[model samples]
Target: MLSVHLLTLIALVTSAKAAISPFTSRPRLQTTFSGLSDVEPFSLRLSPDTAKVCNSTTPGTSGFITADDGQGGNNSIFFWAFESKHDAKTDPVILWMSGGPGASSVGYGNLMELGPCRIASEGGYTVDNEFGWNVNATILFVDQPVGVGYSRGQRIPTGLRDSSLAMLRFLRQFMTAFPELADRDFYIAGESYGGSWVPALASTILRSESRSSGQRGALMVQEDGPNLSPNSRRGPKINLKGIMIGNGLVRRSVQNIGFFETVCSGPASLFNSSQCLEWAPRAMWCEDNLAVCEVDGMKSSACKDAESKCSAISKVVVEDMHLNPYDFRRECHDPDSCYSEMRHIDEYLNRSDVKMALGVPENEPFVGISLDVFKQWEEVGDLWRASDEYVNHLLQSGIRVLIYVGDKDLYCNAAGMRLLVDRGLSWHGQPIIRLRELVPWYLGTKSAGLWKSYEPLTYAEVAGAGHLVPFDKPEEALTLINSWIHGRLPAL
Candidate 1:
């Protein structure tokens, strides 16, 4: 349930619904870049009325792309781009992904989180989003992993590596189509399972760039020929600068070790000390088993069996409490409507006029979440894998990384995030340690959060926010991102 204060903030950001603009009169916007010419048929201009809701004159573009790249066959990924309200040439491009390992960035990042427009459910239209992250950069929302949201395909990528490869291919084509974004500073942000997805994708991009530049060595060629090297021919390199993950499941070991500790004794642990103490031995057991599973040359069967035991230890808490694992502050309700406003986004997107305006095929139904994608990964045993090493690679390669979480979130709590960054990962053979103690971060006078940094890596705890930091503390989320992009630490 939304608090009175949050509801007030929502009202301030959303305008009373305006009448819908005529779809027939809206001019078709075409991309002049040759890379995008092939995708011209899928483009649609957002209505003037919707543009007004964003309090900007810039019209947005929404379309579908067959992000095949010959590797993933043909997966149609749905995307929507809101060009900077300011200058496109000067602004950075930020790609946003949502976790579920199967979630839709379109549904979570765009309508429910940081995008510039909010759906006014009562009025059945969109309204301005004052705390929108687009104030400083061009934000791209994608429905990914092949089967999430509007992205449709015969088969979805099962593991993180395959999915990241698919994303890399899609991004190459995306940058080619929108050449202006090719040179702009780029960053990827995501939450939840995104902790794994973002790192995997960043690792893919970084490795691709490194291999293409011949930084490591000669690109390995397969039996076929020189063309056998995947890096032999590559598209334009993306200007990736940094990455941010909120309440992510980046490393299973750290998450598992810290889970019982956080819930039993940390700042807002819901369990009694006795209960937490009882779970302590089990946590260590799970952690130790995972350590063995992570050993080099370990068998997949051994890993799968160990992971099952590890998860069983954690699942006990989730099953026993019946509390929202995402946010301990509340009881678990309808998973879909847990964050009530999310339901409104569904209503807004499902509108026939809204779908037509966005160039979605008239008969294709929109799905906010895809269970098929999730179950497939479970079957393939890809859910409990880790991406900490990949993130470490990015950190060593000089890409800035930010790991943050809502202190109030139970699943990916701030304590766990702090543990992962400080103790779990090593950079250049040394543990990542904070240069300074956690300090207050404010949006004006209000202390909105606490932050600490180790130069290129930073960790933060949003004070009252939950799993969805942006939605719970919009002002602070915006400030945190702005400070990050500008290469400055967030301060008063």
Candidate 2:
């Protein structure tokens, strides 16, 4: 007899798989966008040459659009679209967003991560990645909020927090430019800080469609009733198929505190120990209106010392064990090596294309934008919360929701995602976990595991991946996503 867990897993997978059909049945739709009256519509084409890395053909296209600032300025939003031969119009569209609050989706999000391409060599062109997401659907790589990538803006905006507005403007402009693709099914997807951007953008589309009419307008609504009535005046509801976040930073309060606690304590008891240490201090600080933890002469000194020690240890682990290819145990660990790596990253960013993609001026000083963005990331977070609420409202009104995460990602860990799902949305019952084993997993030859089916929403865990699961395990990620969008769940 099968174990109860395994039985439940099979049932959930079966139900999910039964939901949608394969991509072959769906035809590709020509995409166009509005708001860019000046630019011309163009079709995406495959590069004649195959990539050297994964030895796969990757498709790409370039286009321009008029993006809005919500505050009043309208700028050009240039973009690259990558699609696999298997992709069709009816296939779900995964819109990629890179973190950095100022990162380039094309560089990191595409070449290095999810898209079909990977950097062949240092400062070189890319090759196709076999693990790319395009095998199932169209992957749109955008340089967003203007001023990022080849996209240009009049004045560099500072601390702008309205991702919802930015998305609304971009979509409107994009659709206007690519009117032929108005009917394509779309899903908002991103990583790192994108945890906030994708949700917020999806929410904006949901809100907009709630007031419009037609198939595109009704896309956000659930398949079942409350059907549209003859007398209804509101626009057609926007259908949101699902959302995928890799190494996300969705729960600001939890992630910030958790990171401090998790990496600060000794490795053996780190996770739990950090939480306990934080509990008391956080509770007291909250009760005292944050006054108790405020920086002061003696307290400041202690805090600084603690921060240095934590930083030192974290640097060593993250650099030596994580990013570099050196064996963690055998390599001689050097504290300064971490600093040197940071400097190397700085030098890498100095490349013109990289600087352009990052929206950084050539002469501007390079501080840690990742940390700085965290400090000022609340704006995007607020937008994300609002968007998530809107999406849930759509669900309550009959829309199905799907959320996925990559397991190996430290930034957007599975634990944080679970907490977000549990607290952010109310479900009909307990979430279900369905595990599917992928043959010949990368890094190791063992089979990989994927989780599926969490109530009305489908939550998946992609194995053997980090912040960019698609980049590391593209085939599995694409298969899982394609299956989810089609409503088919894989067998474990």
Clash number for model 2?
A: 36
lDDT of each: 0.69, 0.49
As a TM-score, model 1 comes out at 0.82
Candidate 2 per-residue lDDT over residues 114-226, each given as its tens digit: 66766664434456677677777777787665556545556344333354565565665444333333456777778776766776677667766666553332111112223
For every candidate structure, what is the RMSD over all alpha carbons to the true structure, in angstroms? Answer: 10.3, 13.3
User: Taking the tens digit of each residue's C-alpha lDDT, what string does model 1 give over 231-346?
Assistant: 33334568899999999988776776776666777565677777777777877777777766567323477776767776653455456666666666777644455666667766
TM-score against native, each model: 0.82, 0.62
* Model 2 TM-score on a 0 to 1 scale: 0.62
- Give the clash count for each candidate: 0, 36
Please identify model 2 stretches exceeding 4 Å from their true place: 1-56, 67-72, 87-89, 155-161, 214-239, 254-391, 427-446
